[model samples]
Target: MRDVLVIGGGIIGLLTARELRLSGAEVTLIEMGQTGRESSWAGGGIISPLYPWRAPEPITALSRWSQTVYPALTTQLLDETGIDPEFTINGMLVLDDEDLDQALDWGARHGQPIEILQEPAPHAIEPELGPRPARALLLPGIAQLRPPRLSKAVRRALEKRIDLREREEVCELLVADGRVCGVRTPKGQVEAKRVVICAGAWTAKLLEQLGTPPDIQPVRGQMLLFHAKPGQINHITLHAGRYAIPRRDGRVLFGSTLEHAGFVKRTTAEDKEALYNDAIELFPVLRRTPIEDHWSGLRPGSPSGIPYIGAYPGIEGLYFNAGHFRNGLVMGPASARLMVDLMLDREPILNPAPYALNASR
Candidate 1:
């Protein structure tokens, strides 16, 4: 029997397993498919929320804590696994001004640096921007990483430390005497003293036996990638609800569309066209560049966009570290740490009340 069993092989599960092993617990991670091939691999990997100032207080807390630790975590992973996650502080530029006041107020309250630019100022920051909007908001502290690289790095780090089970689907939770003792896999039953559901979009389905699971559902998001010059686009650019991310290797990722399609991971031509047009509008140079790839991933959506990171009210040995909606990458590390802290009854990094299983419900 393992000390802990983590369901899901995305970033959240991978990190949680790592944390548990570090705390001297025997951990086993099971994924329905290959690890890191889900939303963790499909995300753009912006280390901060899309608009940091606009996120709720709980999200803001998790994101801020994660940002502080990402540099060190990525460094350690690179040193141990020799796989660089390419953590970079490229900053971000927001072109919309509808929430300027709210953004400014939030930034001031959080002590986040925000610069309000006008006309030529915006163009000076990003030369590729076709024409400067009337005004722009520059958040110089934002950072980003290559999602695929980060996922690979984390998985590599966890391989030798834990019983990492890939392509093994956890079909059901084994609850005996009102306590989750282990999980039922296709092969057989695996026993563990404790279990955590980091199943992302499939979290709710896995917990269906327990009536009224956390209000989590799958929200589909599509993205388009373009091969451009390394320096073609300097910083992450956002306009309306879409944004363009420039990777270190000159690959620009433009996305995405939030749709309510159930378990359908297929990309649509309509979304591809819309993303391409939006990318061009954001950076005119993309007009000449051809799209290299197009894909979609299902994000675990919650009512408050806050993930649950504690034990179920009446269920023993069962915990959740899922339902992060769109900010999974930004909040993964902190969420994983918080989940482990709560499970072990240790001092938590942040207040656990906001992320309790019953908080959102």
Candidate 2:
């Protein structure tokens, strides 16, 4: 029995439970598998703003606020758990003049610097991409966080307080009086006063069992991690919607081809080759970098690319914070902040309009 029962054990669920505990709510977190073993662990750990400057205001505001809160949040969680979560701030690089202008507009209202740069400037910042004639969008304030490490840190931090039920899949959602009271797992039922569904790609299926509308679908993204030279790229690079993230180690992470693969997690040779081809075209130096590994993860996508947040209409004491799509890591912390405010009756940081639960398909 607890004040809140959080479904799913990914980053969003973990953060939501942590914030609730901080606000004096007793939380019980149930994970179908090992905590953070799914898409959360597989993410490239990018805290990004959307491309083409087409993000809605709510998502934009939430992401910007999460940027400020994440460093501090990671620090506090690390101190409490004594584990470094590996959150790095190397900023980002978006090449091409048109993309640069769009990046500037996205950062302009948020006070985050979006600098347009020429050859010398990119050289000064990166010092590796030599003789490149492309214009660059320098997002100096952007950062990255290791989703796996941070998720582990969060689980460890909440271990002493929250009742973590891992490897125990919930088979049913218990509703004694047509209100979310407890979840039925294979092991047993865990009762709670309120429930928040934070399952990432499984969000739609999870809610569907309870006769609820869950507007979430899986968008498969294939990413590759490479063992490469260090300091080769100073910032995360984006060209033609493909991107790269440099690790603290010599390994450079290149990613992500978005496809509607429908829960099929296998990597296609064509997709992998396409990413590699794009890497060579963008940096050219990656031609020497050997590809070590490639993998894929599914993001829960919604109709408008915005997540399904807030309370479910006609469902008392039940809430949703899923469907984050590609920006799950960037939006996780801020989404939790909003969920906490709505659950605890605090003034929300952003207007609760764009992330409406009853959004049309």
Candidate 3:
């Protein structure tokens, strides 16, 4: 029997397989589609949450830990695989006044350098912004990475070390007598001592067959890409609730809309027009730019806005590291470390109690 079977092929599953293999566990990762092409590849690559001060402590902790280690990890990956994920610290600009005082207090308590700006200062930083948002917060510690490149790097890094089974959808868990022994795919059965569901948006559906359904649902987010000059936008800009992320290759990513659209990954013209309008409103220079591409992905959303990252309650040998929602890219690396620590019975790098399976429920 295999030592472990990872059920998803997004960033979480790919990294989990790497960690387990490094720990000397025979690992096999199964994916329904192409590896790393799910929500992991479709995100805007913001390493920090939008107004992170409003997030829960567990979410904040995971994101902060990821920020601490991502630079070194990306550097190592680039050295090894010749693929630069472009992890950059261009910072984030939040142009909203709601909960301004609370966010300031949270930043102070957490020791994150934050500058609260009144009227004209917001316009001075990004002179192209609309006149709606009169206030802003500049968070210099925020960072971003090109998600597609990071995904490619991880897949390349695990090329020889992991048995990557793409185009294989896990239909059910082979659980019996208080423990899960394997998984059932369309082709055949995969036997393993441990099983991890890192399937992103499809996780809750997979677990439902085993009678312990997690409160995870699919949230579809649509994004638009626009080609622009190199110096079109200086920083990752956020106003109201949408954002525009400029890439090093002069591609500005205007994102995203959260909809409960049940595993549907279709990009609509309505959302595209809405995003374009918002993006143009955020930066007037974008009015002349043409949209190059548009796409959508389903993020795994949980009721508590946190992932279930522990042994499934009462299900031996069955674990979960899914339901990270939109923060999967930021949280995946550290979460993989934590999950491997738990699976191998080692001391966790961070407190794992807050993200335990039952904790969220």
- The TM-score of predicted model 3 comes to 0.97
Worst 10-residue lDDT window for candidate 1 reads 352-361
**Residue 315 of model 2: what lDDT?**
65
Q: Which candidate order results from sorting by TM-score in descending order?
A: 1, 3, 2
Between prediction 1 and prediction 2, which has the larger TM-score? Answer: 1
Per-residue lDDT of candidate 3, residues 171-232 (tens digit): 77898998999988899999999999999889989988867777789999999999987777
Clashes of 3: 0
TM-score of each: 0.98, 0.94, 0.97
The Cα local distance difference test for each model comes to 0.91, 0.82, 0.88
Off by over 4 Å in 1: none
- Which 10 consecutive residues of model 3 have the lowest summed lDDT? 125-134
Please report the TM-score between candidate 1 and the true structure.
Answer: 0.98
Worst window of 10 by summed lDDT in candidate 2: 126-135
- lDDT of candidate 1 over 1-361, digit per residue (tens): 9999999999999889989989999999999998899999889999988888778899999999999999999999999999999999998999988899999999898878899999888888788897656899999999999888888998998899899898999888999898989999989999999999999999999989888688889999999999898889999998888989999999999988999998999999898999988889889999999889999999999987989889987879999999999999999999999999999999999999998876744
RMSD of each: 1.0, 1.9, 1.3
Best model number under TM-score: 1
